[model samples]
Target: MPLALLALAISAFGIGTTEFVIMGLLPDVAADLHTSVLTAGNLVSAYAIGVVVGAPLLAVVGVRMSRKHLLIVVMGVFVAGNLLSALAPDFGWLVAGRVIAGLPHGAFFGAGSVVAASLAREGREGRAVATVLLGLTFANIVGVPAATLLGQDVGWRATFLVVTGIGVVAVSALAALVPYEPARPQQSLGRELRAFRDRRVLLVLATAVFGFAGVFATYAYLASIATHVMGLEESSVVWVLALCGVGMTIGVAAAGPLTDRAALPTAYAGLGGLAAVLIAFAFTAHITWVAMVMVVLLGAVGFLMTAPLQTMVIRFASDAPTLAAASNHSAFNLANAGGVWLGGVAIASGWGWTSCALVGACLAIVGLVIALTAGQTAARRATA
Candidate 1:
């Protein structure tokens, strides 16, 4: 693997930490800010909103820059967002900070995947993208839990500050290590948008949107699930998250090899596993051991879907690999927002937390169906 992939992973570490650390700190943030727990949850929603709105826009804005310089600039934005979050005086300012921090979330990985593939041998693109995603998977296992603890002990503000430091390190590493490829030949904001005109490109993007919704639906309610379902203390959320992360690391590492062998089949199998795990999780939630096991499996199944999905999108958008890959992140983040909103609706309507699992299962099945359609489309195209 290229060392530049490490830089991408490191950037992913910071981004993932900032994105998820808030989940563990919701109670503290609520108490400190003198707001309701549900209100503090809006911070998570706000960040998702940012990712949904910013991913494609930022990708387009940064489309013309060298991938290396663009990454550094994105990290700088990420650092500033975290710094402002650390110093936020009120909830509104914190929301603003999170939105600012999240703006680069999707674009960075989208563009970074392209850069990673560019640096790899031709047929190893899936593995290359998986290498970049490793940082995100690792963050769940280590960074998020550690950062959550840091916030609990020191202060929530300190967690953001620590993430700010990580972002700065990523900025420096990217500048020093990643290769500076010249801007894409004839690539422009308009040309990038043109990639969406392809039907297969649209299908793949939709696959990403619906496929990842299952994970987000469950994840949005994870802390509550820990307490209400598993009978765990709030503090145990960190450990459970770590268990989930462990699953994620294994899943992500395995995805590259699996996709390299059979991309669509690998994706469908992973989603099927994820759907089954989530449904089983609802019933297992009351058992500590079972819940722990299920969380790990959920993480594994969810992450295994990522690299192959990216690979599928890149292959589908052969003419505009960069834009399509970047847009895949945009679509996934859109799933994050949509899934969470739908999950919220279920909870708010008195369906209770277990409803999240049911909702997630349904979403996964939807994704699986779409993947089947995409597969058929690919087969027909190949024959034609």
Candidate 2:
């Protein structure tokens, strides 16, 4: 891998850390801001909404700009957003700042993925994307726990300040390490929108929604699960989360070569594996050792789908690879929001946090069904 790609991975690490570390610090934020925990939770939702809105918008506007220049600009937006978050006076302002911070999240990954793949040998595309995503996985393992600890001691705002500093480092790295390229031929916003019009692209995105929802259904309430269900102390939750992150890193790393070997079938297998693991997780939660093992497996199997789903979308919409690739992140954010909401409803209705595992399993099965259906359709069309 080029040194430039390494820089992109580092930026991804910073971005992913800021994105998820907030989850661990939500209680601190709620207490400091004098808001209900539910309200503080909306900060996460607000960021997801921003990702949904920003990914396509930024991809369109950025179509004519060099990827390197666009990455720097996006990181600058990220820096400004995190700084605003650190300085926000109220819950509303914090929410606004989170939204601002989120605007570049998807676009950066989309363009960055392209840059990563473009820099690699033709057959190594999966390896390239995996390298960038490794940073994201590692953030969950190392970055979130460290930042969450910092928030617990110093204050949640201090955590945001730390994220701002990470963003600054990323911005500097991107500017210095990533090489410049000329802009692509000008394409109108309408041309970008056309990517959405394709049914295959929509199906692929739906796979992301269902697949990612399965992961988030359990993840959104991970702290609760750890404390309430696993009989672990609050501090121990961090270790459990780190375990999940370890699983994600392993899973994502394995996804690349598997995806290159087999596309949709590999995707279906991953989705099915996630569903099976999640079902086991629900049953295993009563025992800490069993639950811990299941948690790690869940992370690995769930993340294994990332590269395959992303690559599938790009293949299905090969002409608009940038838009399709970027929009996968939006689909993921949608899943993030939807899964949390569904899991919350389950908990509120008296099913308990373990129910989230069951919910996630169902969602994974649904994703598998979609993938299988798409496969059948393709097979029939081939015979015709």
Candidate 3:
């Protein structure tokens, strides 16, 4: 892989860290900002909303800009947002800061994926894209855990400050490493907008929304599961999370090659595996060791679909990939928000915490059905 891909991965790492580390710091932020934990949870929602809004918005607004320059500009936005979060005086200001920070999340990944694909050798584009995303998995492994620990040891503000520093490094790396590509004169708002009209593109995105939601449904409350369901101590929650991260890393590593060989089959296997694992987790949560293994499997099967889904969207929207690729993240964020809400509802409705796994299993099944439909539709279209 080119060193340029490393820069993209670093950018992804910083973005992933900032996005997830907040979950662990919500209690600290609530106490420090004089708000309820429920209210502080809005910080997560604020970031997701920013991603859903900013992905397409920034991709379109910067359609005329070179991918390299656009990446630098968005990473700059990321830096500013984190800096603001680090310095915010009140809860409202912090929420604003999170939104600002999130605004560049999808745009960066969207542009970065294009850049990574452009840098790859023939038939290796899937791995190249997966390489860029490896940073996200690594963030789960290293960045979030370390940042969470720092927040607990120091303060939540200090954690944001560290993330701001990471953002700075990312911006610098993007500027120095990513090669300059002149803007494509053929690209326009109308052309990019048209990609969304394609049924195939929409189906791939839909797969992301429903399939990935299954991952988040259980993930959103993993700590609670470890404590309330698995009967693990509070201190072990971090280890459980780290174990999940390990699974994520393995999943991404495996996804690249599988996607390169057969994107649709990879998606089929991923979504199918995800459904089975989630159903199993519903029961495994009763056993500590078994639950730990399930957490790892859950992460693996859940993320295994990411590369295939992303590659499919890009392939289907070949003429206008940036916007479509960016919108994929928007869809995933929607899943994140929706899955968490559904999981919470299941718990509130007198179902056990393990019931969230069942909910996730159901969502995965729906996503699988969509994927199957899409595959059949594509086959018929190809033959026609």
Candidate 4:
């Protein structure tokens, strides 16, 4: 691996930490802002909206800039957002800060992926992308739990300040390590839009939107599941959270080689695995040890699509990889919003917290069907 990958991974770590750490601190944020947990969750939705809107927006404008410069600019945006969050006066400002912070989240990853893929050896494309995403997986395991604990002790505001500090370090590392490349021939915005017109591209993105949603719906309320459903002390939730992160790290690391060898098949298998795990979780939540194991499984299966989905999108849009790549991030965060909303409705409709797993299961199955259809369609085209 190139040392430049280390820079990108560090930036990914900072970005992922800011993205997920809020989930663990949701209860604290709600209490401090004099609001309900549900309302704090709305802030999460706000951030997702920012990601959905910003990914393509930034990518289109940034198509002409060097990836290194673009990465720096977005990291700057992240730092500024965290600073705003740390200084937020109340619920409204905090929501605004989240939105601001989220605006750069997807664009950074999109650009970083393109850069990482460009840097990889001929047969190792998937490994490079996975290396970048590892930062995100590790953030779940180490960063979120640590930040959550820090928030519980110091204050949620202080936690954002800490994230801001991480962002600063990432910015420095990125500037020093990521080499500059001249901008490639620019694709027109219309050419970029054409990527969306391809049915295969649309299907692949749809799969991500639905498939990824399954996990987010369940994860959106994980804190509730930990404390209210499992009857664990609030402090112990951090360990379970870390355990899930461990599962994600392992799963994503495994996904790289699997994706390099078999992209869509791996995707189908992963989607099926997610559905099975969620279905099992619905029945197992009553047992503490069983539920703990399920958390790891859920994280593992849920993230299996992370690199494959990106690869599939880039494959289809070879003419406009950056735009297609950035748009996939939009797909991901849209799933985040959609899943959170569906999970909230399920819980509010008198379904127990465990029922979110059922919701996730259904979504995963739907995504599996889509992946299978795409694979079959491509096979037919190849045979014909």
lDDT of 3 by residue, 184-285 (tens): 899998999999888989999999999989999999999999999899899888888888988988998999999899989999998999999999999889
Which scores higher on lDDT, 2 or 4? 4
Q: Which stretches of candidate 2 lie over 4 Å from their true place?
A: 377-384
Each model's TM-score, in the order given? 0.96, 0.96, 0.99, 0.96
Candidate 1 structure quality by residue, lDDT tens digits, 138-246: 9988899899889989999999999999998999899989988888678787777787787777887888888789989998788789999789997687888888889
Worst 10 residues of 2 by lDDT: 184-193
What RMSD, rounded to one decimal, does every model reach? 1.4, 1.6, 0.8, 1.5
Give me candidate 3's TM-score against the actual structure. 0.99
Per TM-score, the best of the predicted structures is: 3
Model 2, range 125-243, lDDT digits (tens) per residue? 77778888989999999999999999999998899999899999998999999988887675555666787776667877888899889999998887889999999998898899999
CA-lDDT, candidates in order: 0.87, 0.86, 0.92, 0.87
| RMSD in angstroms between candidate 1 and the native structure over all alpha carbons | 1.4
CA shift of 206, model 4, Å: 0.3
> What's the CA error at residue 279 for candidate 4, in Å?
0.5
Model 4, range 1-384, lDDT digits (tens) per residue?
Answer: 898899899888887888888887888999988999878978777788889988988888887888899899988999999999999999999998999899887888888888888899876888889899999999988899888889999999888999999999999988999999987766577877888877778888889999999988897777679888777997787888788889888878988999999989878878999999999988888788898999999999888888888877877787877778888889999888888878888999998998888999999999999888878866776697
So what's the TM-score on candidate 4?
0.96
Name the lDDT value of residue 339 in candidate 1: 88
Model 2 TM-score (2 dp):
0.96
Worst 10 residues of 1 by lDDT: 317-326
Stretches of candidate 1 above 4 Å error? none
Q: By TM-score, how accurate is candidate 1?
A: 0.96
